[model samples]
Each structure stands twice: as structure tokens, then as C-alpha cells.
Target: MLISHFLHGPVSAYPRDYVDGAHQELHQHREAQLLYAVCGTMRVVTAQGAWVIPPTRAVWIPPLVEHEIFMSGEVRMRSLFIAAELSPPSLQQCCVLAVTPLLRELILRAVQGPQHAENPLIQSLMLEEIAGLENLPLHIPMPEDRRLQGICLALLRTPDHPNTLEDWAQQVGASSRTLARLFQQQLKMNFNAWRQQLRLMEALPRLLAGESVQSVARDLGYGSARAFSAMFRRLLGENPREYLNALNKLSELNPLL
Candidate 1:
């Protein structure tokens, strides 16, 4: 059944809390959901795609979209459900958002302190703040083909599995070229590119949890910190420290962050 009341009903606030490694069954809301992670990592997966939401960001799930959430480590989650009619046309689809400090505070209050978004002053600011948030490109698109699914699932389980496409092809009983073609057709990216993105997404939560660059590198199967930094810098245009420091900066405003 579709959950339609949160948006159409008078109850606009939805607050939820989850422990480490918590998993929620598939469900859809009538109203769009702003899923914020106050302390840990959240992985939101839908039929359309999969998103890795770190501390400094959140994901917007449009109304009536079946989805499930998996938490990494301990997680403090807060969400707001807006009326479907009130949701922006651009926000009708799910997206990952880079949460601003102001938006973060509004979400916190909406779920924790009081319903500040109910107040006229705060409501306007909250909507404006959300509109201004830049869309983050943090989603991993999955392929539906069983052959590709095996490869993707394996990498998803252990991102540092160190399996080349040739290696994966042998295990899956497909030619290396067929696997490569499947990667392109399903994921819209080659195997190596997809793996790089997977490693990056996996590394974010670990780094945000206070792991050192060297350790994260070792865990991700990089030869050294420099190698990891080069890849991160190349892909994200910033080193690991820059990304981790941004999270630290966000925590200054809201301690839960």
C-alpha cells in the first residue's frame, strides 16, 4: 500500500531512529521524504538506483516510491514528509542532496526539538533552503541482468575484492568481453569505472567515522595513501582530508552531525 497521508494529511513531520546495521522493509510514502543522517551512514536503495548518503548529505525520496534503507554503524535518522502537491516538480524524483547548515538545523528541529517548519518564518526558510541545495551525484545505478548482477553484488559485498573483469568472467561463466559489454549496457559505465565509484562510496562512510587516510587506503586495497588520494582527487576533485574536514565543519553547527 502507498503511504499517502504524510503529505496529504496534517501530519507533516516523520521522525525515525535506527541502530547500527538497521534495515527497513520496502515501503513508500505518500509525501516526499527528506532522509537525514545525524550520526552514521545510510544506504537508500530503490528499484531505480542505490544511493550512499554520508553525514554531510541527505536523500530526497519522492512520494510513492518503493525504497528501503540500510544503516551503517549507529544512525540517528530524521525525516520530513511534504505534501505531494507542494513538492517541486524538480523534486518529484529521488535525489541526493548536499545538506547546508541551515537545512540541517531545520531538519533537526523538525524531527527533534520542535516543529519549527510549522512556523511561518521557519517554513519559508526551510523550503528556500532545500531548494538551494545542490544535487549530489552519489548514486550507483545497477543492472538487472543476472550475469551483471552477480558481478555487481560481489563488488558491493566487498568493494576491495580485487577482481578484474577477466577474473569475474571466469567465475560467472561468461567471456571477458561479454562481461565488459554487459557492464556498459547495464551500468552505463565500464567495469573499472564502476568499481572505482563503488570503492569511493564505500570509503566515504569509513572516512567519516574517523578512519585515517592510510587505513582507509589499506582497507580499500590501494597501494598507499598517495594512490588513494590521487584517485579521490581525480574523481571527486578533492583529497580525502578535504571531504572528511567538511564533515567536521558541519558537526560544529549541530553536535549530532
Candidate 2:
């Protein structure tokens, strides 16, 4: 069902906690949402795609886009709901974004106060900061085709499924060529590429849970830690350890985010 948040002001901040595996049913609100978290991971699914948001990220959801949230682990979310009229034209779609240190503090301050009403300076600064956030490539597009949807859902449920496109095609009662064509037509990517994106998206939560690279790689069906590291570097442009180090550095500077 859709939740109508009749905002008395331009921006609203909400903070909530979800234990691991908790689910927020498919729902929407009238306000554009900037869904952030101070800790844990958020898996946000909508009609268009799925977003695997780590602690350092957030999702910008346009008004009335039906969506659901699945907490990967114990999560504390600090979400901002902006009145649709106050939202900029650029943030009219749902996408994951990299949350900066300053923006995180502003969000926290807003959360520490009222849910919607806020000091004018804080509201203006928050809106300006939101409009400037750079989008991250953390979204995994879901296909519209029923056949492809089945395969995608299965993969999402088990990201470590060690199967090729040929194998999945056979399991889904379609030929390899047909599967490839549908992926291209709908997701605009090949099977391996899409699977890689999914794996990387799922990687962060496990890594944050203190799992070693070797353990995560084995569970994710990678041949070895080296192979997984290589793929991770290629896709994210940084090694897993390095990425975690940077995140740690940020946390040290601002524990609020």
C-alpha cells in the first residue's frame, strides 16, 4: 500500500532499525525519499531494479515508485523524505548514490530533530547536498520477461549459484541463444556481466560481517580468492581490502554515518 506523508515542510528525516532478514513490504510514499543508513546494508527492490546499498551508500527514490526494503543485517536507517514539489527535476528516478561525510552529518542532525520541520539553513543545505550526490553503479536491473525474471529471482535468492547461461537456460526451458537475446533486449547486458554485478553487490554485506575474502569467495562460488579479487578489482576499480580500508577511514572520521 502507498503511504501518504503530507509533509508540513520541504524535508523530513526518519530513523528506523531493522534486524537482519527483516522485510519492508512493497510500498510507496508521496514524498521523494533519500534512504540512508548509519550502519548495515539495505537491499531495496522496486519495479525497475534492485539496489544493494552498503553503509556508505543511499537510495534516492522518486515519489510513488513502489518499492520494498530487505535488511541484509542489523540496520539503522536514516532516511529523508523530501516533498515532491521541493525535489529537484534531476532526482525523478530511483537510484543508489554515494553518501558523503558532510551529507551524512546533515542527515543525522535532521534525524536528531523533527521528522519533517527543520531549521531553514539545515533544510536548504540538505536539499542542495542531495542534488549534488554522484550515483553509484550498485543497481541490478530486473528484466520484465517472465522467463528472465525467474532466472534473475533465483540468482538473487542464491547469488552463489554456480551455473552458466547454458545451464540456467536449460533449467528455465529456454535455449542459450534465447536467454542471451532476452538479457540483451531487457537488461542490456550479458549473463556473466550481470552475474558479476550481482556478486559484487552481495559482497559488501558479507565483507562487513567480518568474513574473510577466501570464505566469501568460496561461498559466492568463485574458484579462488585470487580469482574473486581480480573480478572485484575489475568491476569496482579497487581491491576489496582497499575499499574496506577507505570505508573504515571514513567511519573513523565520522561514526555518525
Candidate 3:
């Protein structure tokens, strides 16, 4: 017998608080969850994709979707869980959505409603807000090559280490050309592109944790924050401060920090 818990109406919104430079894990629930980050930065990984959910956006996790979330710095987040039937089919797929000002305010107001009494207006607003979510294409593809995976795991373990593809190739017992080819074949990106993506991914958590851009740059093997910022802008189309601000906003609404 499968016992089910019925969550009638909208679930209450609560804040998720965290300290600087910390990380945690969360398991999937039977119901879908809407996360809004009000402050700080967060990275979420699922079987389908991995997202660096900055403050200007939110992530929708459909019911029964197993996922893991990591926090980079002190985070202020809020979350709401809605019944699966109330969720749109598009949202049933896990993906990151850009949070507009209207949606942000709507979520804040819905969460601010009275705790005891069910607010029909809030429910309606919540549904409207969900309908307005714009799907985004920002995602990191997980590599499948064992050699590439080993290299990536090593870099993740020590993001500050300055190692060129030649060095990585030697460690993996392959030529630089072979590693480059493997990157394109397995990750659909060239060696430099894959490495830059990894560095950018690593930088999100550090920047959100309130680390200075200079500090983060040094940790990521860049000589200067300006250089790092340039690459970040080239890839993400935003400066570090703007990116962090967006991430902080998402953390404010994130239920799981």
C-alpha cells in the first residue's frame, strides 16, 4: 500500500539561511518545489542537467525528481511546494527559469500571506507566476569520458591549480591532441571551452560565498580579477558583481539553501 500525504493549497514559504563558504545536500520530495534565491549563490545538479542558479533566476524541480544542491556563501532563500496537478507540463521537466521582477514580487507576497488562513488570491498569484517563468539555456553538460572525467574531478578537487591541457594529458597518459579530441567528442566542447566552463562553475560558489573577485581569480588560476571578469563576461554575458547579485536574489527565495 502506498500511503500518500495530501498537501492542500499552497505550502508556506520559509527562509533558508547559511554562512559564508558552506555547502549542503538535499533529497528530492514526492512533490515539486519552486526555489527562489533572494541572496547569495547556489549550484544544483540533477540527472538531466546542472545549473548555477544565480540570484536573477529560479529553478523548478518536478515531483519525484532526485537532485542535489550546493551553497557557496551565506544565503537567504525561500521556497514553495505545489501539488503536481497544479504544475504546468513544461515545469514538470527540471530546468532553470529566469525570474522577472513581477514573478519575484509575486512570490514574496504569496509567502508573506497569513500563515493560518489560506489565501485564494495568493494561490492564484502563485499559479500566474509559475506560468510566467521563462526557460533558460544555461546548463553545464556532464562529461562521459573516463579520462576526461578524471581530469575534471582533479580540477574540481583543486580549482586553483594552474595546469594546461598538456599537463592534464600527461596525467591521463594521453597526448594533448588526444585529450582535446576527447573533450570535443565526449563533452561536445573543445579542451579550452571545457576547462573554462569548469572554472566558471567552480567560481560561482566562491563568488557567492562573498569571496573577493581577486581572491576567486587567484583561486581559479587567473593572474588578475580583471582577466577573470573578462572571461566570465564572455561566457555568461555578465560581470561578476552582477552575477553575484542575481545569485543572491535567488538564494532569498530558495527553500533549500
Model 3 lDDT on a 0 to 1 scale: 0.71
Leading candidate by lDDT: 2
* Clash totals, every prediction: 2, 0, 28
lDDT of 1 at 100: 84
Off by over 4 Å in 2: 4-7, 115-117, 252-257
Q: Write the per-residue lDDT of candidate 3 for residues 13-93, one digit (tens) a residue.
A: 544666755565556766677777666667778765477776656788787777777775555666767777778766767
Give the TM-score (vs. native) of candidate 3: 0.72
Predicted candidate 1 versus true structure: per-residue lDDT over 1-257, tens digit per residue:
46543532332555666888899879898777888877679999999678888876889898789999999977777777776666766776678898887878777776553445466566666677876778876778889888888888888898889889999889999999998888888878899888888888888888887789999999988999999999898876789998778776775566742
Using TM-score as the measure, which candidate wins? Answer: 2
The 10-residue segment of model 1 with minimum total lDDT is 4-13
Please give, for residues 1-257, the per-residue lDDT of candidate 2 as tens digits: 98865444788887788899999999999889999967789999988888888876799999899999999877889888888898877778788888877888888888886642477888998888888988877879999999899999999899999888999888999999999999999988999988988998888888988899999999999999999999988976788998888766655555643
Ten-residue region with minimum lDDT total, candidate 3? 1-10
Q: Estimate each model's TM-score.
A: 0.85, 0.89, 0.72
Evaluated against the true structure, the overall lDDT of model 2 is 0.85
lDDT score for residue 137 of model 3: 46
